[model samples]
Target chain A: MPTSNCSTRSASGLALRAVADTLPLCIAVIPWGILTGALAIQIGMSPLQAQLMSLLVFAGAAQLSGMTLIASAAPLGAIFASTFVISSRHLLYSVVFRQHVTQLSRSLKVIMAFILTDEMFAVSEAHTKRSGQFSALFALVSGFSFYVIWNVATLIGILIGDTFKDLDSLGLDFAIAATFIAMTFGELRRFPVFIAVLASGCLSVLLKPIFTDSYIVIAALAGMLAAYVLGQEGET
Target chain B: MWWAITGMALITFFNRYAFFADFVRYSPGAKVKRFLSYSSYAVLTAIWAPIVFSVDTQTGFTHAGADYLIGVSVAAALSLLRVPSIVVVLTSAAVFFGIRFVI
Candidate 1:
């Protein structure tokens, strides 16, 4: 019994440490969360819907894309497809850390997977590399902390969004484009990646009239294929 | 509403949980890894490209508007400069509204 008690206490301590480490990244998350909520409302989502998405989906890029599709009155299938493709990158994170999580119980694994986000993965991976150990508590704490911060910021945006009118006219949706563009810059220097971006961007524009909302999925797949083909050219 | 929310949530969790379970210890090969590494960038470009530029029936592909054109150009330039994402967002937003105000 004393062993159990000791472990519990240490777990809480580890959790607190995780929170402290992740606090700095929270500053970056706040504006993103707020912008998501604001864009949801601008695109005609109810405050409830926006907050619920932040809580449930918990994916900024997917939520933003979903709201954009919803605003355009896109079909439900397109929304699901976009969400799947956008979040598929999480699979890489899961694969990378799967070997370390085998000891955890199924339920605990479920919780861990639920909160597996890009930021959480980066912080936890860094900790593991630095300390030469993996703490489930640390990873969960980091993820849940971001989760809480993101939702709170989303609520704040929802409140502020309700008070404002003509958000669309202000070109606030440009934030979505800007955000994606900024994200794309990270890998643009790689030749294959650059070709992929160019292929996907040009294909989507040309196919827009035909595919409408679902064009994203088609173009993204084409982009991946382009990258794969170029990757065979011997460029690392 | 619940349908969209639940579907998205489930898909996201499924992706994260894909290889976590002991039963699914499948490791992707090098080629697959290389392919998936570019998914985020490809998907992001696909999402925004159509928004910032589009096809006109009479003309070829064209920028959506001068405001969006300038705003997205600023975003691309800043991103190339390795600016922080949040700053890129805010600065491009300012340019967006600034252009709208001027025109």
Candidate 2:
């Protein structure tokens, strides 16, 4: 149990170690953050508002989609709906966290909940899954690293928006598509999961016109439900 | 807009807190765990399937679009080949524009 605790290391040491583990991801997020900030402006947020959004509401998917919706002058409700849908993944992350971070204080949990982004979720998930325990400080600093870098990158993006503007147009955003595709395939080692992917794909394409981004939530639930059923059948 | 931002932030936080709260003694079974684990994949695909194949960003279902498709395929192949993600991102962008220039 002593070994399981990260208190063996200093708090900053543990945090930095976690940060080091997450460095590669943090690097990948730099350009992504810059693009978000710059895109926020291009889509019509003032520099101050864009920066504030990064400061206050820090989810990448929500900001990106919210920006697009704002550009289209979508109703306030639609913007909120899409932001909620895009960020539905957080619910899973929170559930996953409960398994490892059960001992964290209430205030810590609330604060930790505030900075839950995809990158942070990935890092924390890997750590918790590996050790069967979690370091609250480690999670905090890792989240902080992302939080600081994200805001800094965003400001840089705003200041240099003109120069980097061309980079986005070059289809540089393809990386996101490719990255997610790769990650999805990595998780599809099981046959049932492949079926889930196919089902989700079909359902999303079909539901695109109707539910839009909300289809993602629906498709995810549907596939997971399918996997659950298949797994149950196997058990029997 | 500020109200909406606050609303979104609150909703996002609550979505996150929904599970981590102590009051909820929720533990998912193996079946549900399998399902929850795949949520990310399912959602990611759901969001991007349209983007990768769609010709136009706005109306993605209209027709065949090669530029992004080609770029994504190349990047996905490289990723499967075990290349780093940063490289995958840059390479895909280059390949996308390259194909466009050629066309």
Candidate 3:
């Protein structure tokens, strides 16, 4: 009974921390989710479909990629391949998370995997790395919070899509671009990051004609390699 | 719609589940960790660059209104000033929209 009580208390404590950690991420995700919903509708998705995509895939990049492929009438296999390539980063996330979250049960790991977006993974990994605390409950809380906000935002965007046809005309898409730019610049304080960015951009441009849909993956791999090499050289 | 949605969800789940089941047995090395740190940067920049440089209607690249150039400038300026992220986002959006309106 004492062990049971201790476990329960620890689980709740972790859940509380996860919720706290996810609050800021949810705020950012809301706008992106809404934007995605509006775009989905603009591109002819019904509200139900948009919300369902959000619920199931729970990945902004993959959803956008899938929608783009559908709009372009790409083959079903191509759509799946492209999304899988684009989302391969999640593999990296799982590898890193495994280091800290090894104690979690299989059921908990599966559920957490369902909700692990780039942002959630980043925040949770950082939290655990900094504090050396691995709480499956916290991860679940954060994941669920993000999931709720993302779907709700998608629903809101779908509802408002008709009312806001000028969203793109108003340059709302620039928000995503701006966010990326800000994030990049924030990392430019380091030389390895700068090199990685330059390498990826150049490689992607060069490979675009050859790889077409898979350019991003190639570019990312090239960038990661370049950064890794540079970091090793510096340390040596 | 249902078919497409379900198919995509299944693929996503498979992609995620494979990592957890297969790769979680060992910790990533220092090299892997270093590489992962900049993974998002590469992916995000790859996505952002085309949007920034490609013209809306044209196939070729042109700065034109330079919407991204201006928006990035505002963001940098705001960061330097230590303005809040909300402020930076709103300011950049306003700048982009205002430019679109005038030019």
Backbone collisions counted per model: 0, 0, 0
The CAPRI category of model 2 is: acceptable
Model 3 Cα lDDT, one tens digit per residue, A145-209: 88999999899988888677665455555776665555555556567877777778667666665
Candidate 3: segments with Cα more than 4 A from true spot: A1-32, A38-46, A71-75, A125-142, A161-166, A201-212, A233-236, B22-26, B54-61, B77-87, B101-103
Residue pairs with colliding backbones in model 2 are none
- In angstroms, the error of model 2 at A65 is 3.3
Which sequence of candidate numbers ranks them by DockQ, best first? 2, 1, 3
The sequence of per-residue lDDT tens digits that candidate 1 reaches over residues B1-103 is: 6688889889989999989877775877777777765666676688678878888889877886899999989989998998866688778888897888865
DockQ of 3: 0.44
Q: In terms of lDDT, which candidate is stronger, 1 or 3?
A: 1
lDDT of each: 0.80, 0.72, 0.72
Model 2 per-residue lDDT tens digits across residues A48-121:
88888888888877887788877888888988888888788788878767766677788888889988776676
**Residue A29 displacement (Å), model 3:** 4.9
lDDT for predicted candidate 3 compared with the true structure: 0.72
Query: Positional deviation of A1 in candidate 2, in angstroms?
Result: 18
Best by lDDT: 1
Clashing pairs in 3: none
